[model samples]
Target: MNIVETQNLKKFFQSKKGTVKAVNGVSLNVIKGETLGIVGESGCGKTTLGRTILKLIKPTSGNIFFDEKHLFDLKLNPRKAKDILDNDGIDPKLRKSFEKNKYGLSADASVSKKGPNSWRIDDDRSTYLVKGEENSMKVYSVKDITDIDDKEMRKHRKKMNIVFQDPVSALNPQMTVYDHLNRPLVIHNMVSSEDEKLRKMVDILNTMGLKAEHLIRYPHELSGGQKQRVCIARALCLEPDFLVLDEPTSALDVSVQSKILKLLDRAKDKFDVSYMFISHNINLVRAISDRLGVMYLGKLVEIGETSDVFQNPKHPYTKGLFKSVPQPDPDKRVKAPLTGEVPSPVNPPKGCAFSPRCPHSKAVCERENPDLIEAYGRKIACHIFGKENF
Candidate 1:
């Protein structure tokens, strides 16, 4: 089952220069129980795509469905309530009150304030109302919470949580680690009583390889690795089915990076968590992710099982990314790094965004963009995959 799905999702930022297409026509599905890694260089819209799926950013256009439900079509059912009132033998006066209050309309002879600066009168005789007068008000025609209502979205937030990069910045300076983890559990009603909360907090700290004493210490008192562990513990407190790990180990030392990766892997099994792991480190992605999606300039160039992507890269951009990784063997020769910087998202290339930096750019590559197609059971967006040598 796909827990999350996005179809032709797009996000555009309007600036003085022009419109920046941060995410353009991106569509992907996150299987219910697998870690899907999204790897790309910085500013490739990897973070933007993750946030947009979580509804942190309102998509410019497209649809998102969660667990087979249309997220955009959520609304209070009015007809069902009418049927209940008619058949349930409820008092007619109560029904009138329910209709008036539920829909946010005026029951008596008074003006009803609607939305911003809009007003309507209940009396049949009234043609107009005073401009500045306050009237009975009700919330009607609520916009999508991803667009307007944030508090409503909080109910579903526990299902999807994100662990951002920079552990120090992500954690509070004043609060102790114990307080940090306990707060979310308490706020989300994950625990029953104070004792249970404390016990669970201590257990979580231990699972993250931190002693209970360390929980009393503030984030500043801990090392970079320890701070990251605390951040991981905080994310795990939600017990979320899907986690967005945004560069979780990017800021740590190499040695500490290994430990964090191992901890994440262990946590996945213990908690049965699925992740959308976003990072620039291909080596780390290869180690932890079961599947990989290579992103470039707000578009996915290639995606497949981890081994297939690493062994036989289909797209030029994917090949370039793999070549850029430094090998440890002394006898192995290193290829030159990817040529040219990533193109501007505001004004991407005419056709293939990576054509400027691609080594195998052809006439068709510059003239038309390629759609993401499946070949040999792998998804790739390159025109040269099945074409003859030019």
Candidate 2:
């Protein structure tokens, strides 16, 4: 079961020069009780993608499904997207059309627009409102939360959370560790009394290998590792079903990084949570992730089982990333395969973003971008690999 899923996710920013595609058409999922690691270069939109999924920054367009429900679809008109609670009152023709498409619109699906106002169609006919389990006619009661009011969204916030890269800046200077951990509990009404809150905070702190006494200290009074532990404790206290760990250990010491990683591994099973671990360290991602995704210029170039991807990278960009890793034995070192600098996101290359740097660039790779095609039990976006497999 997937805890969270994104379909055609995109996030763009407008500057004086042009529109920057921070995250372009990223589609992935985090399975329940599994760690999905995402690795890429510094400006590849790893952090932006993580933040956008948590709704810290709104997405330009896409769909975010959480716990088998449509949590967000920015393109959908919330005012008109109503929850089809039951099959009762639905037009037979519309129901049949939706059934034929398997609860989603197909490319050749000829759905009429003579239904209720809630049932709307876009000009491009790429999206429709009705969706549900495959082959099941029963519709969900909760509607898409694209335009949901802040108060309503607050109810879903506890289910999703993020741990930023910089722990120092993530914590409050004036707030004590106890205050930081207790705020989420109070806001969500997770505890009935102050005593219960205190007990819960102490238990979570202990789980992070911190003493209860440390709670009284402010952020300035703690070490880098301690501060990160506090952040982890705070995120765990909410008991979120999904977490976006954005380079959680990058700012810590080498020794401390291992300890933090171990704690995170333990927390996943203890809390029954799924994670989207975003980092620049390929080795670290390989060590902790069950599945891995490689991003380039805001798009996923390759994704598959961690070990399989590391052993055999299909995409030209993914191969370059692995080759770029430093070798401890100088005698075994090999020259990196990739060349040229990354193209500016404001004006990316016409075809695949990595074509400018790829060694096997061809005329077709420069003319048109290829879709993510499945092969060898993995997904790769490159013309070198035929697209018929998907």
Candidate 3:
């Protein structure tokens, strides 16, 4: 089953010069039990796309379905009731009394001296009115899930959680590690009492390779790796089915990065958590992700299984990214790096977004956009991959 799906998702931001296409016509599906890695350089809209899927920012246009349901649709129904008194037809004053009692109307307003006003009478007179009988009405439109009744959304939030980039800034400076982990559990009612909460917190800390003593320490006291672990623990407290790991190790030391990656791998199996691991580290993403998506300037240029993508990258941009990673072996020579910086998202190049930097650029590449086509079990968006060019 597909747990999440976004179709033609687009998000545009108005700027002084022009509209910036932060996420432009992007679509992807995440299966129930697989981690889908979104790898790209910084400012490629990876984080924006993730947030858009979660409805943190409303899409300018497109559809997002979670488990085959339109997450944004909300409907409400409202009604008011009034009583009929006596055979001469309900006295206006008495009708007002009934309306007040049934609908909690203001006590001071005098009932207008009129028979069966359009607002009061139902053509079918069968509905009964009794004092204190419940007459309920919905007072508001059903809002987007995020803006709707927060108490209700909190129930569903347990299924999805995010561990943002920058652990130091993400964690509260004043909050103890224990308080950070326990807050979600208590808010979500994961544990019944303080005792169970403490137990769970300790277990989570242990699983993250932290001792009980670490719980009392504040964010500033912990190292980068330790702080990221706390963030992970906090996400785990919900027992979420999906997690968005936004560059969870980017700020850590090289040694600490490996340890954190290994910890994440172990935790995935232990918790059965599926991740949308967003990162700029190609090797780290290749090591952990089952599939790889190469995004450039808010668009995915290529996406395929990790092995195939690394071995035979179809997109020029993907090839550039792979070639740029330094080879450790002294015997092998380094390849030439990709030329030019990424183009401004506000004014992306016409036709192919990467045409300006693509070495194989042809006249047609600058005039016509390429669709993401499927071949060899992979999807690629490049004119060269088309049959005519081949």
Candidate 4:
């Protein structure tokens, strides 16, 4: 079963010069209880996609399905844009008319007009209402968590949590480890009494290989490894069904990294959690992921079982990424993988974004974008994969 899925998801940002396509038409899934590792260079929208899925950053347009329920459906509507301009300035009578006629006011769905050109979800709505369109927002037919009130969204947020890459910044310097570990319990009302909270906190700390003494110390007093373990413990405090782990071990020593990875591996099996693991370290990703997705210039170019992808990479970009991984022996030296700078996201090419950097770029690769096609027990997007090209 799929715990998370996306369809044609896109996130764009408007700039003085043009629009930047940070995450364009990305569609993928996270299977239940498996870690999906996303590997890509910096600025490829890997992080943006992660943040967008969690609703930390609203996507410009897309459908996000979580646990078989659509969580968000955002579209643009110009007609209802005026009412949201200045909530106070709109004429009461005129606003009512616009809300009813111009915008096909559905049964109970809301369409908040923003600025003059776009109609976004009512920011006033409890951050999660899903199933919204320009004409008529679908009301009860589809269960969208976004449509639920704030209290309900909080409940869903607890089901899914994110552990950021920077544990130092993610932790509070003023709060002690005990405070850090117990906050989730307090917020979620997980435990009835102080004793239960402390007991639960201590148990979690022990599982993460920390002593009760460490709980009283502040974030600064702990070593890098300890801080990361605390972050992991905090994320699991609620026992989330899905976790977004953003390079959790990149900042630690190799020894510490290995221990943290082991802890995460055990936690996943013990807690039955699904992970969307994002990292640039191919070797680490290879070791930890059940499946891997290769990303480039705001698009997923290839994805498959970790072993299959590493052994038989098909997409040129995927091939380059694998080739870039360092070899341990001096006798097995190789050249740099691929050459060419990543294109500017503000004005990506009309064709495949990797065309300029791809050695196998045919004329079609420069003129027409290719859809993700399945082959070699995986999905790949590249003109070279077409039967005619081969």
- The top-ranked prediction according to lDDT is 2
The digit string of per-residue lDDT tens for model 1 on 81-154 reads 23332342433443354355443233343434322333323333222211121332122221122343578678
Clashes of 1: 0
Ranking by TM-score: 2, 4, 1, 3
Tens digit per residue, CA lDDT, model 3, 1-390: 456666568899999999999889886767666778999887799999888777767788865545432111111111222332223354455444445544333333222211221121222322121211133321111112323344665666787889888998889999999889878887778989889888888888888889989989999999999999999989987888778898899899989989888888888888887888899888889888988888999988888888999998888899998888776687765568889999999999999999999999998899998877776678888988643247
RMSD of each: 12.5, 7.4, 14.4, 9.4
Q: Which consecutive 10 residues in model 3 have the weakest lDDT in total?
A: 70-79
Output the number of the TM-score-best candidate.
2
Off by over 4 Å in 2: 69-143, 329-331, 386-390
Better of 2 and 3 by lDDT: 2
Residue pairs in collision within model 1: none
Candidate scoring better on TM-score of 2 and 3: 2
Regions of candidate 4 where Cα sits further than 4 Å from its true position: 69-151, 386-389
lDDT of residue 370 for candidate 1? 89
| lDDT pick, better of 1 and 3 | 1
In candidate 3 the C-alpha lDDT for residue 205 amounts to: 83
